[model samples]
Target chain A: MKKVHILNYGLGNVFSLYNAIKYKHGNVNLLNKKQNFNDVEILFIPGVGSFNQAMNILNRDFKKLLIHLNSNKIKIVGICLGHHLLFTEGDEGGACSGLGLINGKIKLLKKRNSSDVLPNIGWREIKLKSPKLSIFKKYDKHKFYFCHSYFSKLKYSNQSVFSSSYCHNEFSCMVYDENIFGLQFHPEKSREIGLELINDIIRY
Target chain B: MIQRIIGRIDIKNEFVIKGINFEGLRKIGDPIEIAQKFYEYKLDEIFIYDAVASLYGRNSLFELIKKITKEIFIPVCLSGGIRSLKDIERALLSGADKVGLNSAIVKNPKLLKKASKVFGLSNIVATIEAKKKTDTYWEIYINNGRDQTGISLIDWINKVQDYGCGEIILSSIDRDGTLKGFDLDLINFVSKRSKINVPLILSGGCSNYNDIINLKKKHKSVSCAIASALHYNKINKKDFLKR
Candidate 1:
């Protein structure tokens, strides 16, 4: 009956994430600003929309909670905008400082000189770097759901940044370290694969 | 990729499912049984909606949902009674794979922000029950279509985009349960105007496979979430793979 707190950073799909996490016996807690989020091994900071609005809603110690969680070696996973915010800085609206756990930048989709559509949506593949990775436990080597207008430009060391190539170039799958991970695409709406990822992250 | 077949299970009073003809208040089928058989058919996703959750203000028949989602192997979307984030949390903890919120989003649009912020948009869907107004545009409704929010359908669609809902289930309350035909206006309206790039599920009034095929042909982005036709056996999903 361990608690898995979902950070309500003012954006992202919390219900589905809570649903997926709770299914795996991760006693899920929805942590908003006014609530207490203490001593949880697994923390999820999920968001949707653009980086500007997501950051706009951030206030006080809540925004930096991720850095604090990471320092404690707690397992953290960010989805879409939530994923991009872990980078050193985001270029979505302007130069905005992020949690900086992952070294990278967030870029908006440009219309010119690109054959791919905006939003970088639909089902795409994420090439796995290792079979031993915990997140890869119940998933295939590829195939995942994605929806985003911005992406990260950072690289990771111990973590694998699986790439989505449906667009002009390949983009990161947001996996890094043994502790932190991100998905430009949502694992919750990803159906089974998404659910599996959530379960694995909770176990980690 | 194996195309997943998702069944939309809309419930009311823990009995009659959505799109059920009350004039004919004859029970279409036991909902939990319908849910079981649909799982037996190997559906990829199951959407359980409590149509009366909003109007009745009762808890999301999670006790019933606990029965279905726990037994089934696939994902289940529990919609209907989700008025607050706490309701969404309650439904999720009850074993819903996804939580579908309608009505309240019309009243307090910011609810989507709070829900999506915690859940993620991919898990967040706005169920828009649209009907064709006589003036050649669609009108949005709430509370199981009992109250008219008077929000322009197009404006509301855009509004959800900003609200950060990752998907839109554009249902035609007018066409729901009526097997005569599906509402083409609601389908076409969303397909034309949506900019959010989220999955827009078209529910209501699916009489035959032709209605589905016709929809897929015209709107390549939308997916069909069926109810009535499947319940009466007028249309079997086995034929879905044929197209």
Candidate 2:
């Protein structure tokens, strides 16, 4: 079984993500400020809740820990709000600095037409641009559960950027740069298909 | 947009139960077993309402929810007795993705604003239980349809949206548990008048696949939540897979 560390910043659906990983028989550990990450192989950031509140509670220790992980080239995964927070800054609640792992900003979804709903909640498809990448090698067409108002707007497109879709308009759905990765959908909540993707990533 | 087929579970004292028009309650099955079955059958979401939580002054389903969350992977919404921000916090922390409010929000409307601000708009669901009063109007019922609020259903729908709720679950008290099909007239009225700009989940009735298909054909924007039809096996997994 793969061993992983999940950052528990006092919010988000950490329990669901924890259960999802554990259900796949992965040995999971919840990381807090006082915890050490010497045994951590993969760092999973599950998404939910407010961006500002999550940022406010990060404290100095967790901030340093994440920066240290980034410098060490440790494999990191961010989901939804967690994905957005990988950027340099976020605008949810108010303008706040992020972990600066990605070159972008978080913006709210704008309605192209009046019929579009905010906080787009439901199962939607994410067309993969990099199918050969280990994370998305299994499927051609993928549909995952999404419930968020804000998304990551990549500043530039590189080969590492894997997927994109139009909720209101085009937005980055998945990003992979070296040891860093991000998914804007809830894999843990996406049922069997999602679990397969998660298991693939963990095994890889 | 694909219309979601959701399973609605009403629980009292840990056992899943259902009642006609929200009265004459009786046991149905274990909440955990029913939830796991629904998950395996591929229900879009599961909504657990504690019908007697307020009367007891505590959300007794917290432990039950923690257990369910471990086995079920999809989103779950818990309702009943959520009167304050702390209650909403505890519910979300207890593993519910969304918290549904009815009598508490109807009594203290600002609770909607505070809860939305603290939990974010997407996490709050406003529940409206409506009963037909006349040929053209329905009255809003509270306390699980035991008391009528004398508030026009349309006006209350607008009010909850104005107060900043992200979604509305409009359950018709007249057709609940009857499985005759949804109250079409009531649903059409809300579909036409609601400018809330959130997903609308219509509950109560829904006996078969045709009822859901007809609802989708008529109201493309709304989703249906079935209880008795799903609980009694009136509708099967194949029916949902056909769509």
Candidate 3:
């Protein structure tokens, strides 16, 4: 059984992700402060609130601890705003610094045509560029529920597994560079396929 | 784009209840059980409304919503008597993914702006209960469809979107709980007139699969919320998915 630590930083609905892991029968714990990172086999950062507000709540010591945890070779999975937090910076709520776990910056999903709504709130299919990757093989060409206005634009590489093109722009939906993974969609809210993928990630 | 099938549960005093035309309420079962059942049926979303939250001057769906979110993995939308920013905070803390506002937003349209600013646009949903008044006009109703606000459906839609509501859930009070089918004319009229780019969810009077599919076909952007038809087992997931 993998030991999971879910960071509840007073932003977003952490319990949804908490229950998601619990539903998969994974051993999960909620880490609220900087000191609770011990024995964390899998570090999960889940978020759904404003980026600037979330960044404000993450204390300086905790930010340092995140880097320390990453250096310890702990597998980290970021969901939604959690995924945005891994970037070098974010423009939501008037620009804020992110955790800088990944080499990317967050930008608002540009409203291209009249049909594209801001905050892209609905289910969208992810076009997998690397279909052979075991971590995302099941979700290749499958739709996942997304509810965010901002997305990350990283330097494209073979490490980027999936992408969703919307509003005349494209953003990375699944980014994996070594042991770290970030998902822009809410797998817990995405029904069965999402749950299955989450289970596989936890066990992997 | 894939349209969603939303299972709506109306609760009165912690019991899941349903009524016709927003009257003659009858308890169906526990909200937790019904919500779990909806999840089992693979409904895309679950909408929970406290049918009489305003009448009692409080929100009674907090614990019910918390319990539902623990077991159900899908998004749960909570509405009814949501007045202040604190109410939105409490509901979100209690596990509601999105907070739906009705009487509260109607009373003070500014509430929409404030809530959206704090909770972000995507987390705030404005639920409009519109009753058909004439051939081309539908008036918005508040307080569980009992009180008429004399506000035109189009006007309310425009206002809420300006206030930054992420989604507009349009419930036809005239067709609610009737199992006759949605008011396609009303939906078509509103969808055409509205300038907002957010998703518009149509609710009330869903009887069969065709009704759901037809709404998707005619209006490519809207989602449908079903209650009576699904509660009574008149329509199932297979019926909606079958081409």
Candidate 4:
């Protein structure tokens, strides 16, 4: 079994991700200030706040550790705001630099019309762009819970495993670049399908 | 966008309870058990509101949320007694996806702006417990609908959006637990009057499948939160996804 570690900075709901992993894997640990990634097989960046705020924390605390993890080829998963952080920059909460693991920039989701709401909340379906990818082969057109005002724009379209449409704006909902994976939706909060997806990621 | 069916579990002293117009409470079951059942039913979301948290001046739902989110893998929105940023932080750390504010925001409107900035707008939900004041107007209520704030429903709805709340849970005090069907007039009135661009979660007075269907037919973009109907199994969970 792979050892899973969830980054627990003073932002977002870390416990939900921890509990989700512990429920199935039972070998999850929260990577806090005193922790090191020496034994971590999988590192999860669980976040639910503004990109600039989260980026500031990551830049201050985990920059070197993240570089080390990336170079070591350790599997890294980013959820929601954490997914936004995988890009080169984000416009949320003013412009800020990200981890730059993937080539992209995060921008506010444009409204298609007056009726479209900001911070698109609730469940929506994802269209699998790379259905041949093993992790997402069975999840085409599956609805996952999404709650964010911003969306990711990747430089390389091939990095996006799944794309979803919201407010008439098509954005990457799931992306994978080598060992780094990013999900704009909260899989931990997406019920059975989400749980199965998490398990699949862990197994992969 | 899909019309979501949310299970609303009203908690009073750690026990899931239901009532008419937010009064005459009757205990239903444990919060954990009720939340687990909702998750099993594959409801789009779970709303856990501590009925007495604001009146008592402390939130007791944190521990309950910790236990519920441990196994339930669905989004959980918690309300009642969220007064400060610290309270919001504690709720999120305990595994809540969103924190709903009612009485606290009524006391300090700026807190909504501050909380939304610190926690991100989507993580903050504004809960409006409303009662019909006139044929065309509704008034906002707080402290479990026991106290009234002079703020009009439409005005507050607009202001809440401006203040940066991502979603609104509009509960009708007259229709809550009545099983009479949703306050269609109230929903229509607000929809027409308020400049609301956020996702609205309509609560109260959903008795059967027809009520939900009717609401969905009329309002294509909104979601509904069911309490009495779901708690008593008046409607099948499968029916929620139908249509």
Largest TM-score belongs to which candidate?
4
Question: Over the stretch A85-193, how does candidate 1's per-residue lDDT look in tens digits?
Answer: 7788887657888777777778765544322234454556677554656546446555566656677766553355566664365666756766777877777756555
lDDT tens digits by residue: candidate 4, A10-101: 66788888888887778888888656678989999988778888988887888778888999989999999989999999998678889999
Most lDDT-accurate candidate: 4
lDDT of 1 by residue, B142-243 (tens): 877777777888889888878777667777777778886667776665656655455667777888768877776776556667777777777765775342
Select the stronger candidate by lDDT from 3 and 4. 4
Q: Pick the candidate with the highest DockQ.
A: 4
Query: What value does DockQ give for candidate 3?
Result: 0.55
Q: After superposition, how far is residue A93 of candidate 4 from its true place, in Å?
A: 2.4
Compared with the true structure, the alpha-carbon lDDT of candidate 4 equals: 0.89
Interface CA RMSD, all predictions: 5.8, 1.8, 1.9, 1.1
- What's candidate 1's DockQ score? 0.14
Interface RMSD in angstroms for candidate 2: 1.8
Q: What is the lDDT of residue B161 in candidate 3?
A: 87
Off by over 4 Å in 4: B241-243
Docking outcome class, model 4: high
Q: Evaluated on chain B only, what are the TM-scores of all the candidate structures, in order?
A: 0.90, 0.96, 0.96, 0.97
lDDT of 3 at A160: 72
Worst lDDT 10-window in candidate 1 chain B: B18-27
lDDT of each: 0.68, 0.81, 0.83, 0.89
Give the winner by TM-score: 1 or 4. 4
**What alpha-carbon RMSD in Å does predicted model 2 have with respect to the real structure?**
2.1
